[model samples]
Target chain A: MKFGVFYEISVPRPWDAEKEKTVYDNCLEQVRLADELGFDYVWAVEHHFLEEYSHCPAPEIFLTACAMQTNNIRVGHGIVVCVPEINHPVRIAERAAVLDLVSGGRLEFGTGRSATWTELGGFGADPDVTKETWDEIVRAVPKMWTQERYAHDGVCFQMPSRAVLPKPYQKPHPPMWVAVTSPGTDVDAAERGMGALGLTFGNMAEQEKKVANYHRIIQSCDPVGEFVNEQVATVNFLYCHEDQAQGIATGQRLAQTFGYMAAQLVSAREAYPSRSYASFGLLPQARRQATAPGEQPGVPEGLCIGDPERIIQALKGWESTGTTGVNFLLNVIETIPQEEVLASLRLFGEEVMPQFKEAPDANIRNARA
Target chain B: MPIYGTLALEEYAGAAPVTGELANEEWETDQAEALTLSYEIDDTYRLEMLPAALHPSIPLYAQIMVRSHGSSPVGAFNLAEVRLMTRAGSHYGGYTIGAFANTTESVEFLRTRYGWAVSLGDIALNQRHFGARAHVEVDGRCVLDMSIVHPQPITPGDFLVIAGFHLARVGSDLRLIQSEPSYEIEMIQRGKPRLTSIDTEAFGDVRVRPQNPIVATYLKGSFKLGRVRYLIDPTRPATEGTEQI
Candidate 1:
């Protein structure tokens, strides 16, 4: 499986203007080094009004910076909120095309409807219409890229035919992806013939099941764009070191804070806003843990943490799940220093990535024998 | 303590269905004048008042005042209530924290039919030349009294953003009580609201946080209650050629 680094660009409470700059600079520096280290992608998110949990409302700017600074690592807009209110489809099309041009066509246009109540409610965008809006926007953006002059009369926009300009450097357009937080969103991506940008953390068993369903469904997909991006990418946390103890302790702490920050924005669980949110699973997982007294809650085994051996073992589990790529969330809650983060990336590239990179060729030879 | 999405059906449940919709489907209400004032609340109120099923993250407290002369199960009357904004995962929902009406029948209709934990109280949202004011008093104590002025009116969206889900169990189906209230709003003005009176802990003990009063909108048109829908996540967000219901 291909290796990529993901970013939420979190800045915990007691935040100020300088803290945000430090976070951004640190992320950029990490991206530059990851590209040099031969990492495949650098993914980031777009969230608004979520406070310190995720300060990245505009990710296209950062991705553009990545494009200008790095030569190899694909810059990913892990997602650009697709709802019309949050961002008009027309604006997204224009911006994405320009970015792809600058990045020399290494762009993954991932899209999603805003999940948090703070974001949805703040923008005055209706949750009821988000799914419909997301589908419409995702389908329309690619056409805007390929077609010389694009015009549409759809549920979201109605205009007399006019040219949507700045077609990308990619032949048709950059590969399209949709962010999948819930289990079923994977199926949505498959059916629509888009790439599945898996946002939720899951174990090998869960990943295997999800990926199997995805590959099965994608076989008959009638794509929204001209071609299907048949790639399955899932997220994982990474903290690599020679010392197994240090890696687990540091990585797990960062992972806990990662979960906490995510929970803060979306967890109205056990409250009125979360009445329908029970399906999101974190609360349900916690509730089930409450049932079995004295049992330590299972840290999601999907993350590639621990020393090189343990990290390789964990990643091998994910590789068996049929994922095309693994996006590793590198720094969370600022628990790991920037220098340590760079060191971990360096370690991952030097020791772990080579095996996975060579495994496909080895597998082909074994099949032949 | 982690406040993300949680299943809140149980928290919102326990209010007996008063609409009698299961028995009959002839209940409809249209043409009403109302004023709604919304506020942002602290985490304390968000955790305490809303239940786990709701996955309460956005702490919303709204006071709605209505005067209806049109048609409904209650014929014609005046009523009002306080709604707390909630969410069931991604879906927006609300709880009737406290409610009050001028008439006794409306009070019973609200509680027995709509499941609002309402008590007898005075509620009004009035247009006073310069601005609009919302005042609510449960029993003898004033719970909500806030106003906004310099009515800089604009075209309101087709529907008000204030509506949310009312989680109810009708039989075995987990019905997400969806509300799409359309307003023939002749006026839509947004501005800073000034709270002159200060008594948040008078009524249901669900304190109205005095800090951040976010955005306020005043409407002068008729309101219509839309049809309710069943709340099913479909176990996944993927669609298999299934048309949206």
Candidate 2:
């Protein structure tokens, strides 16, 4: 299974002047370290003008820098806003190609429509049209890469025959992925023949159900993409230390805070009028409102806090759930230091990755049964 | 050669306080949280912040503006590298922030402030149309400081013209007060008024508008409409003429 990490570069309220530089430098160092550590992929996100939650508004620059710094880990646009208003398709192609070339062909193009109303409104994008825009632009990328000149006419965007150069390293285009937070989007990705970067924010059981649903859909998909890339990836909070209690205790509040923060931000623009409306423990509160309090968050739910063994157990639950890959969300909310984050990565790579490091084809075959 | 579609955004410095998060695992959450905090706490709004070394330090601002539904030669009257200019002053200043886009959604189209050229990588437009263009003026003088579709699409039908421009952070918050449009968004939407026309005797020599026009509509940024052109920059003109192409 492929492994990747997500970056937000948060500098929470009561900001320190040096916070920004430190976080960025540490990130750069992490990418360099991941490269040497035999990690598979390094993914970055693209966000615009949001305080505390996200600082990396321009992820391409960061991704490009990572491209130059590392020789292995496939750089990812964990997502580049595909909406024309946020980013035009042509620009997406150019940026992806440049990153691919700079990184010597290691680029995975992940795309999505901004879910937040603030971002949608800011970019002048129609919230309803986001999904459609993502599909159109993503489909257009490959054609742009392969053909010297092509033209398009659709509901939203239209282009004439023109050469789009600096094609990506992967033929047709780099590996394409669609970030899906819901199962419907997962099935939708499968329908389009795109890899499901499943952002299934649920327990291990829910993830398994989602992955099972994806596999079924993919097996029957006509496949819009060049190939049937039916991989399902899930993101889980992670923090590893030699001392299990220290890892859980130190990471508990931070990990829970991270989960609550992520859920709040995702639901914010739709939930409340302002960001301060984000109260701590909102996720748990929302869960309580929706379900029984005694219920666990999910198998892969809550923070994967503990020693390496516990973390492995959490991941294995997800693996059984049919997850093709895992995007271990280390450093959630920044309670841990860089040293710990790296050590966690090293430990996971050494202890966990090996357990699943067989031939991917074999794994898929075994999982299929 | 890497043919880049270079364009410019005039007068309006796209957005304020180009904020960015570091590239770390928490990068996603940090950015989302920080942005949410700013929107919640700060009274102002920011636009078009994409990471780029275009200006070494300054981030690229994605500005959306209204344009005609046709192919227009996209270029500015002039280009230069100015330290910084704004609505209130030459440097740190104030702004009359206005919201643009469909009413149901709080969409704000970014306008240009200064005359600066930018490379938007090459792109093409299809299905052009006609319509009235949206304007953001300063002191009644039409600042050529907005995004003009130098290389836009040419077809038939009104469009919700969208373009991008360069900008720098002005202040923490530029309080926006929305007033009635001096003209009318509906009229522009329905009547489809034409701003600067091509093929005119005076502007004929400019090669201003290509034979076709770009359609302006509220593209929902949807992908269901398969194989659509997300962005179009006519500035990086095709090597061959329209007929040949």
Candidate 3:
């Protein structure tokens, strides 16, 4: 499977004055390394007010930095919070087009509504209207790129029809995607005719079932834009080393830390409990419980968190399951020294990626040049 | 190409300090023991149940009853606290809206000591393996008879956070006090609070008539006060209260 690096830009607590710098610098360096090592994309997440779990609030800024430093690697907004409160639709349309122009058309516009009350309430967004707001912004952004003037009478945006320029360098618009963490969101993404960036697929069997369903549904989905991006890019942890023991050890440590940090950010019910939180936990309870407590927190069975040979074998199952690409989250928790993370990327490039380079169907990607 | 380079990203210089236990496996904190059952009421209810003194952006009322086992100033207490979701231009935590405590000790300790608007009441907090029930009566009038069943177990990844907020008082001048305590809690469950009854006349304009209560369970907790940040000191003049934020 095709692989790319992902960043939540996780910084552990007990912050120093230089914490932001250390995290951003390491992240930019990773993007540059990924570009040189023949990686596909450097996907960045947009999250707000989540202490340590995600220090990245402004992903466009980070992705711009990624584009400036990398030549070959595609810079992705794995999501821009698709609500007017976090970001306005017009501004999102403008900034995305600008990034596309700057990055030489290497942009994958993934969108999503903010999940936590800390984020939604912080931005004063109505939790009830978040999904509809996401739908409007995601649909309208493409029209902003192709049309001379864009306007909507909807309450979310009351723009007087005006030229929404300068258009993206890509002919129609960049490929659109949605961050799918909920169980049926793969189907939802397909229905909306967007790429399914599955954030919480637990196992190969589940992924196989979901991916098959996603493809089947997308064939008949009414497109939200001119073109539909039918692809499944599943999120997974990646650590490769000559020694299998070392790889799994480092991988599981960071994986567990990531899970713990993610859990802490899962909206505190005592703070802002609501009925809208039914689908908050993406991975099923039964699936998560199967990993046994002592093993790493989110290391589901048969993931790409091992040595070159092990990772290669594991990916074979994923590819057979109809997976298009794997978003390899390369860093977290600040425990893995920056240099060691760099080394992990280099090793994956050298040993694992080459095995799939010659595969007949790598990915029929939206990387339209 | 260089148009966006001129802009600076939003950054927080510092944050309210909390234990990093939930984030890292190596991170550890002293566990506190308390039993709490809370309910989520409507925001309009905050206009009455929550003190207007807090000037909360949004109000959350919980029919919280507690059995302080460790580090909690001894004894059992129930508080129908209307908490502000945010205040003073930051989300440090929720503040005491309006509170009622069963024991005289808890009422005075929380009110006179911490500036909470705690009053005396008759209350019960019953917690079982499967579910919990909380009942309250203020001024010899039954106020709350709520129960929450079929608790959904909370996984460690989604941990319970400390309830942090400012306590406002209007006696002898307007006083706003940020309480000095950090809570360390373990084990939590989520369920809906079934409200049997609520009378707003007894609690002032608080019309908290909800069919479904956002019920929650938190247990095994301790609290220790860290450095307290004072926006308004009771000893200070009234002018100081509004200027602090």
Candidate 4:
């Protein structure tokens, strides 16, 4: 079972410069600690122009910097907007190959068509063309890696005969993954032979059906990639500690902030132009008005809030989905203190992680026999 | 099986060049109009299309682009077509779109500079474009879209540069270009029978000069019959790249 931490650089409304710096500095520090603790992967999301919510616009650069500080943990592009407008296929191929080379094959290429209007519109990409653009780029990267001096005269881009050189360290290119917000995409990823990074944020019962459908399609897929890395992974809000009540108190507000902000960004496109990068599209009327006396924004579901024993019982449901890994979205909105984040990692690693860690000897011993 | 091929033209009969123009003077707006042009290839051409089920093992599309060689300078378009044909008494597949490609002299720009070379045994190339010397493949007969634009003031020699390969050929070539790689010209050809070379440039930086420069191609086999060529409307720009379902 692989373990990773998901980052959005989230900071809730009452923003300050120092708080922002601390969020990132703390995140980098958390990644360093995670590496020391034997975490498998460190993932970062690539979001653009969503001020206050996500400042990780230049994720490739951040991942490159992360590559230096960590030795064991794999660096990941949790999701690089794969549409041609946001990043040309050639550009994506070049960046991914360079990172794979730098990381010594410890890179996983996760791709997606943007869900928010701000990013998609900023690049002048047509929503109608998003899926096709995603499919073409995803299918094209492996070719660009293997082909010598490749040129493509497709609907999106045309290049003259020039070798796209410096192939990746991973054979047949780096591992391929696609972010799926909906269950339909899970099956699409399986059919295309890409790992499913399900960010649906739902219960174990929902995930079970999603994973079962994905496995069925994967069994018959003629992958566009070099190899079939049939794996499914998911992310959930996490704040674990020795005392269950304290863990909940520390995680609740920040988790709610991350959840609420993500939904607002996606839903805003319906009311205004998604491509209008200047505006976040959050109209005054849409803002959550002050409820009657003491109420606040609704609490989000699927959040893991408890001690090791309770968290373990909640996570057992994840195994039912047959997922290979689960990324913990910690430190959302910076509600938890830096020390608390580190302690949670320690407690979770000592008690919770041991149960899920895949024995290194299992695969080797099976192969040798 | 060979998936697609192009028709030989005794006289190059085709459409106008591509010009980047907006639907309106909507300044700074993201909306832009895209057009596509298409052509059909005959049975004599050698190329094959594998079934979709055999994807990574066999790439689904072989993309090509076309540039202006006359007074009219049409922009680039991608070609992907699927067709059924009979090759040596067997059914094969084809995919073609409207686009332009570089002549033999044009592709050499990639290899001579960066020592870039494609392992053609793995991908498919048109015998009409690469000639008999290059390792072009074909298992069955199929149709393809190779968009070749003829700019205005039609002259004897003019063409666009075409590059890129199917999955079998993407490797160090992709990496080098991404990391500031260069290319050189190795071969040049005029028409279908004669071939030659000009000069080389960085693989990523091949340009079409003076609007209409004469281009060349090398044919793999001799043809006794005639093939179809397309002539598109000058006002209509070619929209021939990838299309979302």
Name the best candidate (by DockQ): 1
**Alpha-carbon local distance difference test for all models:** 0.66, 0.48, 0.64, 0.50
* Each candidate's DockQ: 0.06, 0.01, 0.04, 0.01
Across B203-244, the per-residue lDDT of candidate 3 in tens digits comes to 423454432243455445455544333444322221223332
Stretches of candidate 2 exceeding 4 Å from the true structure = A14-17, A263-302, A361-369, B1-245
For residues A249-311, write the lDDT of model 3, one tens digit per residue: 988876665654554342533343444443554333222442211122345666677798998
**Full-model lDDT, candidate 3:** 0.64
Per-model RMSD to reference = 13.0, 18.3, 13.9, 22.8
True contacts kept of each: 0.06, 0.00, 0.01, 0.00
TM-score of chain B of each: 0.71, 0.21, 0.62, 0.18
TM-score of candidate 1's A chain against the true A chain: 0.91
Model 2 complex DockQ against the native: 0.01
Which one wins on lDDT? 1
* Second chain TM-score for model 1: 0.71
Q: Could you give candidate 2's per-residue lDDT for residues B1-245 as a string of tens digits?
A: 11111223222334332312211111001000000000121111112111111110011111123322111112111111111101110011111222221111111111222111221211112212432223333234332222123223222122212111223332331211111111112221111113342111121112122221111221211111011111111222121110110
